[model samples]
Target: MEGLYIEPTETSPKVHFDPEAFSFEISGESRPEDVRKFYKPVLDWFEQYSNYLYWLTEKYAEGEKKLVQFHFVFEYFNSSSAKYIMDVIAKLGDIQKASPNAKIQILWHYDEPDEDMKEAGEEFETITNIPFKYIINPD
Candidate 1:
């Protein structure tokens, strides 16, 4: 399945999802005027990928596990963006639950000295049981 890659804009974040590597990242601020339009494709891509992965695993019948790693780093996101973020996390959680044998990591990166960002990461971590890695990126 093809992955979705969106370039970052002044009012949005960069989205990189590579099914080959099973790695994904969304970083930067996300407060686009049309939040639904901005996030619909992302949500759709995740659903498609999840289904593809499941099908591939079933067809291969391999004992080896497939893992997906997601990284989220946002400087500032509006309320609309926040809901999308939650939706993304929920989808990831569902995937993880379905594939108990697989490993999924959700890393939250924040700028060093940005207390608000750090706290936001913590809050997200609390809401979801998905394993989270809080990273402090240095300038």
Candidate 2:
């Protein structure tokens, strides 16, 4: 499956969903005027990717386990964007639950001295059951 890539906008983040790498990343500020519109495609892509992966494994009879890595690193976001972010995390949790053999990791990256970003990551961790890693990157 081809990867879904969206470049960062003035009011949005850079999105990189690479199936080959089994990695997805959303980073930067998000304050899009139309939150739903901006995130709908991303949500759809996740659903499609999950289904494709399931089919490929079942059809090919691959014994290897499939894992997806989601990286969320936002310097700031509005409340609406936050809701969408949470929704994405929930979707990933659902995928993991449905596919016991499939593991999903949520990596939350934040600026080392940014207290707000750190706290935000903690908040997400509390809400989602997915395994999360908090990474501090110095600007």
Candidate 3:
């Protein structure tokens, strides 16, 4: 399937969802005017890709890794954006639950000395079963 690549704007984050490579990433800031509208396509695309993944595994091969590496690098986001983020995470969790090979590694990137950002990542780790890798920016 073709991938999704949305450029970042003043209010939205950069998005890259590549099912061919089995990866997804969202970076930059996310405080769009309509959070649901902005993220709806993302959810839609993921649902389609997830169905493909399940079909591929069930028909041809079983136990193949459905590892979708997801990166979330947010410099800043509003409280409203948090709800959308959780939606993405929950969808990922559903993908994981549907397939044993569906393991998602979420890498949360924050600037150095940004304890709040780190804490946010930790909070996500507690909220979902998706494994998280917290990364501190070098710059």
Ranking of all predicted structures according to lDDT, beginning with the best and ending with the worst: 2, 3, 1
In model 2, the runs with Cα more than 4 Å from the true position are 57-64
lDDT of residue 18 for candidate 2: 90
Best by TM-score: 3
Per-residue lDDT over 1-139 for candidate 1, one digit per residue giving the tens place of the 0 to 100 score: 8988999999999999988877788989899999999999999887887777666665444577665679897888987888788888888888776665566788888888888888877776778766688888868
| lDDT (Cα, 0-100) at 11 in candidate 1 | 96
Candidate 1 colliding pairs, count: 0
Off by over 4 Å in 1: 58-64
TM-score of each: 0.88, 0.88, 0.89
Model 3 accuracy (lDDT, Cα): 0.83
lDDT per residue, candidate 2, 1-139, as tens digits? 9899999999999999998877789999899999999999999998987776666555433466765678888988999898899889888887776665566788888888888887877787789866688888766
lDDT of 3 by residue, 17-128 (tens): 8877766789998999999999999998878877777776655355667556788999898899988888888888887766666666788999988899888888877887
Which candidate model has the greater TM-score, 1 or 3? Answer: 3
Alpha carbon RMSD to native, model 3: 1.8
Model 3 lDDT-worst window of ten: 58-67
